[model samples]
Target chain A: MNRYPEIADRLMGLDEAVSRFVKDGCQLAIGGFTITRNPMAVAYEIVRQRVKDIHLVCHSNGQALDVLVGAGCVRRLEIAYGGNGRYAPTCVRFKKAVQRSEIEFEDYSNYQMSLRFLAGALSIPFIPTKSGLGSDLMNYEGFPPDIRREKKVASKKYAKMQNPFSEQRDEVVLLPALTPDVTILHAQFVGDDGTVRMKGLTFADIEQAKAADAVIVTCEDIVPRSFIRTDPDQNSLPPFFVDAIVKVPYGAHPTACYGFYDYDPKHLNLYRKMAEDDALFREYLDEWVYGVSSWEDYLTKVGMEMILKIKANPVIGYAPGLDRK
Target chain B: MIQYSDNEMMALAAGRFIKDGDIVFAGTGVSILAATAAKRIFAPKAVIFFETGGIDPSLDEIPMAVADLRAMAGTSLNSGLIEAFSIVGHRKLHTVAFLGAAQIDRYGNLNTTCIGDYFKPRTRFSGSGGACDVATFASGVITFMQHEKRRFVEKLDYLTSVGWYKGGNSRKELGLRRGGALAVVTNLGVLRFHEETKEMYLAEYFPGVTIGKIVESTGFPIDTSMAVEADAPTPGELQILREEVDPQRLICQAVLAAPQK
Candidate 1:
């Protein structure tokens, strides 16, 4: 019906998705950060799905977000807080993009992103709060010089500030309403009618659903209406809020789906390795997410036996979670 | 036999600077490894607040990326992933690890912000999150970065956190508290500073990495080893570093080869 195929078709076709999202100019806002992060799948799906002009906003400074930015899906980013682990560094792609002046970057604290979502959910123009007041992140798109080099330092301004009415010292950072063209969310269960349910803190998902004009929900398994009706309170997003719903198991293969499945370190390492080599990244996605006909087909090529083998081998020093593998 | 690399060795040096009963912030690389190694070696009682990963008593290899936080929480020693988040994001703990950058100055400042110019220059890197807060109030901050010339610039394009811009004692002159790079361990050597001027002097050396190489690469001047008596990693420290500190030796896995048969 549209220039691209249906939403479900777009999600499974790796290179197609990447071209659409990473290169095309589609303004998209993703959900979740590190722990409960659902965006990686959507990110990979974008690379797999090929939706374009992607814009990401979240509370984490991790690699999934970096992947989208790195793939060049991001023309501009609106984020509150973001970082990879400490030793690795932050937004390597963003830094390089900034160096090259390749993209426009609008940074806010994660709280600001959260507030934006809350404002959207609450139906407001912008939340009138100051969260990043005195911190140095206010003026510059990035940050000030390393305080280490200074013989003495000047005072700083933050990106967000806190409320005087409350006793908190942390910033209240104001977030303007973000109305993305579409929103993509990953969840545990989805019905044919587009209902989402989760076991943990859905964070600002409901707000995200309310803010966007179009929404797509991806899931590992699709439940019937009876299932969702049984535990309606547990449902994170209602059916009407979601425009499209696709069920793809192991959708969160590289990124964990939270309570549903433990993280796959092997897949993560593969992504890390892929990021180190652009050709490999494209090639791998081409062979995997896009090339395969379905989730079952992709898993078969990756080898379920290999996954089981990986499951048997505890990730060495990193402990084994609840054994979802 | 335990296998380690120069980077892991750097982690040990960074860990050594941590004292007992200190609060720490953590990220990945040597920051994560060094913090754990420090706990394994000394200051076992040192209080560490993981950045939302409940990593203080982490039992497994720390996932390097934030998404790994899910893996970490799912697997680490105690409570669920949510509990881990509480420890890092909200819980008030001490002495955590942080990643370092290319251009660290004489005063113990680090630059992970940008490359070209502040007004509008080259590249823009990931900026501060809790890094500013950790670097601001921690007992002391330890910086870890691979030592290289391309990285060590005269002035940082932008600063990620507040390091000792002046010297340790002089930080107050610029109006800062307990926030200076106390130790910076690189592949080439170990360095400490004048708590105020941030003036640096070589404290130790790595066998393969040379002083000349470091001198050529560093952005600032280093107190000559010949000019001063340098400290050495004791056998005990070395033994712990090779064995218990990183028994699995995850650091150089990024690029390691099978032992030459």
Candidate 2:
């Protein structure tokens, strides 16, 4: 009856998958850009389990990054940007953490971060780019000297070298590669065969997956092997790369998943209001994250009206005129 | 006589800089408005793209952020970050990027990272997302700012993106092949770089805005000898920006008090 018997062992619950791969102080990469397709369900589960001291590497993450940092689960971060689209220009928790010096942080441009992941996937030690040539990203190293010597941290923020092939004066910034201990992503569909398919804008998820030692994927639906195999072009990653697969509908809530739903403006607006103050943020975490028994319970709190309101029109890929204000 | 908001006039003024066949890299807020205005009104053939890898999206609805789902819908191609950067620095393409910053200097260098020490900041903004990359790789950059004494500083607290890079051949000496600050659009007017020295100079002051106000608002001395009064927004231009571009008034709602000459 099972179309793909090979991947039957990989299918597991959210708790087991996260507990198995994500551990204390491990280097992690989360896939998404700003406000789209964040692995929120898994991020919440990590918070519920109280996974501590995570070293997060990302390019331009939004809700997931904010939630994890806000929950006090992250200790060190290598990121490009920390802001939601329109909700919070600079993520409230992230800004507070940086200003308070609670966590060690470093900054890179999106291209530099992407190229680092690409280098890791290519099995190269480092990569070169023209970005951040004269910028302070090259001048200031946010990580302390001790942390630089620690495992999974780059020895230097950046290095400058003359182009070996060029006869004239030419320079490029060399960035160390990033091979995360585990990479987490949320997708529109994952086949029973373990092939992952993302609907719109992969946004370096493929690169992050390839550069990680392990990959955990949460998806909206689990399709049959026969259905997913009919169109291989749509597949984002092959079966061998994904170590864990969990089927969780509305997994990327508060973040847009193309063809499924738009970002929850009402919820994000509420989060923005609560995240401003320390006491209010804790209460928000208690009600939204800790108080909820399960993802289903969380959905109940989100309510059916809000769900229907944010539902995307399949053809358009977002809720048209959904009063995003 | 037509009355236009600051955002409407700013968008139209920046839109005029775009031309046919340009690859426009857009950030959020007024930058998105200007990109849409450029395509619909000024340069119909110009393409608008996002750093998140949505190339030439239909943009039927205005996107609040570069990663908004609307940016991916009806796009010519849906790729990822790497592919998008390839197009930005592509030798063949003429890419023009639009950005925003918290602080800027006489050389047009921008600071979007932090306001204080590197170890601990008084204020930490969303770090250089892709502004640094586009400034390094694109053919030119147009920045949007609020004209204020604090914002237009003589020296940046932190240089997150290189503009002219200490002026003249400094940017080129730093190994970047092309791209530098082209113009700065603000609530009061437009500022352009000196042809040779690369220092920012007042190029245009909006209608009802005085050059004296601009000089006073700037943190450093600025050259206003070449400045002229910018044309007021036309009735047709305002209509397109209001009715068609952003009917919801998501970004164009703020109506500043009329400027006194």
Candidate 3:
């Protein structure tokens, strides 16, 4: 029989092993709508793991994608939902890459994301879809549009007409399926058996897990199976759905954890200033993620005192985990 | 005295009602200029925010476009653009500014999201981002857009964010809390919710702007409040706008970088 704490281990990664677990061609999904995305800090583990050329799917949380994009590990992207600016704009890189024809892009909608997950869960061929079609999205598949036009003739109290600037009927929109290479998510808890826990169901994420060849998770806490069974409904990823889970606290730091606390300010200030100069942006990445030998080293560089100050401050509305305000 | 071009007149009319502190947002294109003017001339202290890009309104240049800035809240003032999202979404500031749609209806609701029905939208523009948050979070919201019949519609297919539907004080009928369109600033004139019925009413007009043109453009009846003024641009405003603010017109994103002060 396995020992009490050792039983919690599905597998263990030492300094070098941790990096190896995050192999290439793995489709990753991270939780977060806007405010509370799981920490890409665990993703830093992927980078430290030397994971390469992987597909990243960010639902709601834009920061996780930014982390991977900044890391230069993303080869192709399948983004269903990204916040306006929660993370750096990969779309720019994706756009530039597309213009150069350097990479592949597959933009998706929330509903379609859910259908894709349903496909993976059901183990189907592809999620036949409907959403985001007809609009420029259809005219320009795989490329983000200046605006998406539909097939309606009437205007509303909020929206007026399209480019015609007149009330004319457009066409129908169909949202296609989204399947990531690997799905990476952040959770409040992952039990001994590997059940993912988050704020909600996140249909898109579920689909990514089902569709992806494999799934990886970055968790805040690793507990006994008994603990997770206490609230099964809150369990997002069952052991059957998830393969690996990394335990890292304050992983979402700059990006923001959900409700427990908000994003770390100095870190955000670091990234905001990066746009002024890419060199500076890359340098910050090196210092923050790449430079550190491990998550522990990253913390040391950021300084334990600073982390305490951040923790000491009242958790802001944006994230740590809960208050959806 | 500052020269009063039709558009400048349009700006001044919108400038009214902007208090010392406001969460003024500047969208894309010329709409940004009107919003900047409002912040520079009227709401200086208002916490300036945006569609997620850099936070402060003090960018030397507007970058290539809105998307170029990403939608993060960080700004040139603090940290870089990318970093600011973490700061703002985390609740660092209290106010934010947003770019409004071309057409607004009787209610102050905006429609950046789509043109038709949700199922089969005619135009699926960038759906409401933090705009919903901005309209709801900011102390007050001021939307800017060009003035034209096409821009001012009878109704928006989607209820992106309730601007001043049923008017500000009277929106209890629709059911909302904290946010309602405060003012709609456009190239031709200004529109606000009626003090009561939540109807679109003329609060002010640009110099040389006629009541007929404004009414003709609007889908709903344009009611008149007080005898509105032209509120021409002040020499100080033009000087700052042309020189200190946007010498290269980068910040203004002006197509024709009008003569510098």
lDDT of each: 0.54, 0.91, 0.50
* Candidate 3's TM-score: 0.52
Top candidate on lDDT is 2
- Predicted structure with the largest TM-score when compared to the true one: 2
Chain B, candidate 1: TM?
0.74
lDDT for each residue of candidate 2 in A149-184, tens digit (9 for 90 to 100): 888999998899999999999999999999999999
Give stretches of model 3 more than 4 Å off: A1-9, A14-22, A80-102, A124-130, A143-174, A200-203, A312-325, B1-261
Q: How well is each residue in B1-261 modelled by candidate 1, as lDDT tens digits?
A: 334466666666677677787655555555666666677777786654444334444535444544444323433242222233334333355444454665666665665545676546564555544454455545566677667766666665555455665454554433332345667677677777654356776777765566777788776666765433234456676676556544555543343111000
Docking class of 3: incorrect
Of 1 and 3, which scores higher on lDDT?
A: 1
Candidate 1 chain B lowest-lDDT run of ten:
B252-261
- Per DockQ, the best of the predicted structures is 2
lDDT at B6, model 2: 86
lDDT of 3 by residue, A153-235 (tens): 01110121222432544322223344454566666677877777764223245555666655666666778878889889766
State the displacement of the C-alpha of residue A66, model 1, in Å, after optimal TM-score superposition.
5.0
Q: Candidate 2 clashing pairs?
A: none
